[model samples]
Each structure stands twice: as C-alpha cells, then as structure tokens.
Target: MLNNIGLPGLLLIAVVVLVLFGRGKISSLMGEVGKGITAFKKGVSDGSKDDEDEDKTLADGTAARDVTPEAETDQKKV
Candidate 1:
C-alpha cells in the first residue's frame, strides 16, 4: 500500500501538513515529541531500578522499602 503511494503521495501529505500546521508549529511539535520520548525512557529506567531494588530486598529479607547507600552497609553491620 505504502509503496504504491510513493513520492507523490508523500509530497501531498507534506503539503497538507504545511497547510494545516505551518513549519514552525510542526518543528515545535516534533521537539515536544522528542522530549516526551526522553521522559518516557527515564520513567522506564526508574521503574526497572525500583523493581530491582524490590527484588533485592525481598531476596535478602530486609524491612527497608527502598535501597539507599546507608542500607547497603546495614547488612555489613549486622
């Protein structure tokens, strides 16, 4: 379907976009999308770290809800 449309189809889409949004608004929209992607990645990484900390605490039978630098040494002190 896409291959059949080809360059002329793409140009028509671009023209419609330009007519509807103009260049500056489109650039700003793209920038926001990039920021959203970055923030989404950060959130995913943060969630993974939280999960890892949960697993670590569960495996060790610790009462701490979250891991911290002090928590790392708590086990050593015991």
Candidate 2:
C-alpha cells in the first residue's frame, strides 16, 4: 500500500498534515524531536564511557578493583 506513495503523494500528505496542525505546532514538535535525538546520543556516549571505565584490568588480567571499603573493613575484623 505504502509503495504507491510517490513524491507527489508524500507532498500531499504533508500539506494535509500542515493544514491540520499549524506551522508553529509542527515546527515545535520537530524541535522537540531533535532535542530528544541529541539527548539519546549523549546518553549512549556516556554509557559507553562507563563501560570502558569498568573494563580496566590489573597486570594479572584480573579486574582492577571489585571490593568495597565496607567489605575491606569486615575482612579486617575477621
């Protein structure tokens, strides 16, 4: 069904949408969409950085640090 929509058909649809929702509304919606995409990209980059930080290894190939300070104190008490 959608395959039949050529450029003219798309333009017609866009015109109908613009008529239904005024230009200002459409422009603001597009602006919000752009902001959402930018925030999503930033979140993905920050998550990748966190993964890289967690992946650091010691010279023996073990994880660099796993124990918490509270666990260390408990071990000392034993």
Q: What is the C-alpha lDDT of each candidate?
A: 0.88, 0.91
Off by over 4 Å in 2: 57-78
What are the per-residue Cα lDDT tens digits for candidate 1 across 19-64? Answer: 9999999999999999999999999999999998886676668655
Model 1, C-alpha of 54: deviation from truth (Å): 0.5
Which whole-number lDDT from 0 to 100 does residue 4 have in model 1?
88
Which predicted model would earn the best TM-score?
Answer: 2
Off by over 4 Å in 1: 1-3, 58-78
Q: TM-scores across all candidates? A: 0.67, 0.73
Instruction: Give the C-alpha lDDT of model 1.
Output: 0.88
34 in model 2: Cα distance from truth in Å? 0.2
lDDT of 2 by residue, 10-78 (tens): 999999999999999999999999999999999999999978866896557678865678978898899
